[model samples]
Target: MSAGTSQETPATARGGLFVTFEGIDGSGKSTQCRMLADTLRARGLDVVLTREPGGSDGAEEIRRLVLEGDPDRWSAETELLLFTAARRDHLERRILPALAAGQVVVCDRFADSTRMYQGLSRGDLRASVDQLHRLMIGHEPDLTILIDMDPAKGLARAKGRQGSEERFEDFGLDLQQRMRAGFLALAQEFANRFRVIDGDRPMDVVAQDVLDVVAAALPERDGDAGA
Candidate 1:
């Protein structure tokens, strides 16, 4: 599936919801996504756990290129195109199919990250990338959990865990600060669909807050207790 192609299906056919986690490094997105997926599964809901820049085979290939490839080799346009390409494959193969099967799709990051990282970070390319998002993934998440945290604190946590930084992580404080601002702006823009969670809190507290938000967004599933 190419980025521009639309895989149209009836609204009724889309039986499940798509929820994405957005935040800077070490903001607990991965952990929260997993916890949420597990909770949903325990409630007898079919759930899919996935991540951006890598989900399907093609996307994973692109992920390697984007994350580990020569930094000087790719332009902003090249980066955006590769990311979108991966997203197209992911949606056609993983996301859409899972949602159609009535499974909740919990993704670590999605279009919002692109908007913040590639789009806003590059400034001039922001408009074009946003256009690509509209062209490619026309659907937005039913709910977005923005794990808000201080970039420095998050970076320290990430460094402690990984022992090293990737190319993106190596961009230093300025870029991370800008990306944080970008995420905040996006959250404001999509207030109805976005919930900002303080990631500075304890892990259990953050998890409980996330669950509360998810439960509120999906009130219909409240009666379904966890297994």
Candidate 2:
């Protein structure tokens, strides 16, 4: 389906919840996503916790190219294409299948990240990003949890992380601040499917907040064999 098209059937029609988390780096989206997946699984809901840029084997390879190289390894447009490719692979190989099997797919990040990161860095390519998305990948999650936090705090946390995947984080704080604004704006643009969570609080507290939002929105399983 094209990104511009909307499916009429509820997300649950496919037998799963497509939940994606978005935020500026260090907003703790990955942690919260994992927590929600584990919590739901414990409740007897089949859950598939995954991440973007590297969910499936193909995407993971693309992820390494995009995230582990020099900061300027790819131009803004090229980087966008790479991210789009990864997302397509993730959807085809992991997300769609898991959802079709009636499992909750909690993705660490999704298209919104692409929109924000690219728009913030490239500035003039936002429209191209949208156009590309509509043409190549037009699916959105049933629910998107956006963890909001200060840019300074988020940048610090992200820098402290262990990994060579610091390409985006290497943009420094200015870009992250802009990305933060971009994400908040997106939350407003796609309000129906987005729940903005304050990520500045204690980890457990933020986790519960995530749980609360998800609990209120998760669809009933109804004994779906696929689940």
Candidate 3:
């Protein structure tokens, strides 16, 4: 086992498990994160449901700036900084506290989205954003679920609910395709910490699969491998 894997042995680790969900728009990550949290809570574990870019109060303000602001007002680097700022507040105020209390933290989106969206979308900002991620989050998630889906399908679903596209969502097909590739590559690079799910499946089926993966990833439930 590698050093990182050795250190992650559940028998020796006392911190709460931090799991993150990642994918394109309308990939059903938000729903699945809630489902997984509910499942873990049912098992008598304390669970916290949170999201990136807006978990904490300060982060929410930044989220508005990034998501609702005029497109001409912010450059890619500026957008990246806003996200990093939100992430810093989220980690300091929410995530770390919940983990310290031994509650499982299931985030809808986290650092990986930054890499896939900002890094892959902008290209020039990848290194800086990654450096900020390492400096802010310190530790990677225990497990990251990448809900892989076709861009066209995902965007159609997002449009149905959102009605209109936000700046990021309005990036069109080319950017979404690149974002999907970026996520897959990141998953491959971090195999032990990543799992890819077929997002085209029905919501309940996808949720069940995510639950199974989460169950298998937990150290204490190793015996219940088929959950």
* lDDT top scorer: 2
Worst 10 residues of 2 by lDDT: 1-10
Sort by lDDT, top down from the best: 2, 1, 3
**Full-model lDDT for every candidate:** 0.79, 0.83, 0.78
Return the TM-score for each candidate structure: 0.89, 0.91, 0.88
- Give the higher-lDDT candidate: 1 or 2: 2
RMSD values, in order shown: 4.0, 3.3, 3.5
Q: Between candidates 1 and 3, which one is better according to TM-score?
A: 1
What does the lDDT come to for candidate 1?
0.79
What are the per-residue Cα lDDT tens digits for candidate 2 across 155-218? Answer: 9999999689998899899998888888888888778888999999998999898888888777
- In candidate 3, what are the lDDT values of residues 72-115, reduced to their tens digit? 56787777888888988998899888877777789989878888
- Residue 152, candidate 3: alpha-carbon lDDT: 86
By TM-score, rank the candidates, best first. 2, 1, 3
Task: Report residue 111 deviation for candidate 3 (angstroms).
Answer: 0.7
Q: State which candidate has the highest TM-score.
A: 2
Off by over 4 Å in 3: 1-14, 163-165, 221-227
